[model samples]
Target: MEILLAIIVGVLYTAGVYMLLRRSIVKFIIGIIFMSNATNLLVFLSAGLVQGNPAFVNATTVDTSHLADPTPQALVLTAIVIGLGMVVFILALKYKYFEITGTDDLDQLKQTDEHS
Candidate 1:
């Protein structure tokens, strides 16, 4: 399962980079989303998967060695919230840019910059 997840993470990262290299603004946003998800998965994978091991311990619990780490989970959750905010901001910017420029192609942005 770990191997599969690692492969998936690699694929997602590759796809994200490929999308980022595209000229379309929409594709760039997709790339950002892909990368964010990949990062979350990578963090989760690094923490190691422990089946039947709870993160929280109770009075009846005698062994703490098999307990799962919660730090990565918290970090991933925080990252998800931040990534969501970033995506929303970027979407708003894309909308405004499209409204004014009437184009989503990044290459057009170069021409505008050159003129300025």
Candidate 2:
């Protein structure tokens, strides 16, 4: 299972990077989404996939021998939320860019290169 997931992550990264290098704004947005998802999966997998109970201490004595770590889960969850926000902001930027220039092709952005 871990091997399969690793392979999937690799594929996701490759696709994301390929899309990111394209000349279309939509493809760039998709690439960002794929890359973010791949990153999140990588982080989650790095935490190990041992089958155990939740990290909750019960009663007086604290026995954490077979408990699962919660930090990675929390981190991944937070990252997902942040990634969603970032994607939304990027989409809004894309919309504004299109509205202003009426073009989604990144190559057309060369018009602004003269100013810089």
Best by TM-score: 1
How many angstroms is residue 29 displaced in model 1 relative to the true structure, after the best TM-score fit?
Answer: 0.5
Q: Write the per-residue lDDT of candidate 2 for residues 3-111, one digit (tens) a residue.
A: 8889999999999999999999999999999999999999988977656587778696476776777888899999999999999999999999999999999888787
lDDT agreement of model 2 with the native: 0.91
Worst 10 residues of 2 by lDDT: 60-69
RMSD (Å) of each candidate, 1 decimal = 1.5, 2.0
Error of 2 at 63 (Å): 3.9
lDDT (CA) for every model shown?
0.92, 0.91
lDDT for residue 29 in candidate 1, whole number 0-100: 98
Residue pairs with backbone overlap in model 1: none
- Give the winner by lDDT: 1
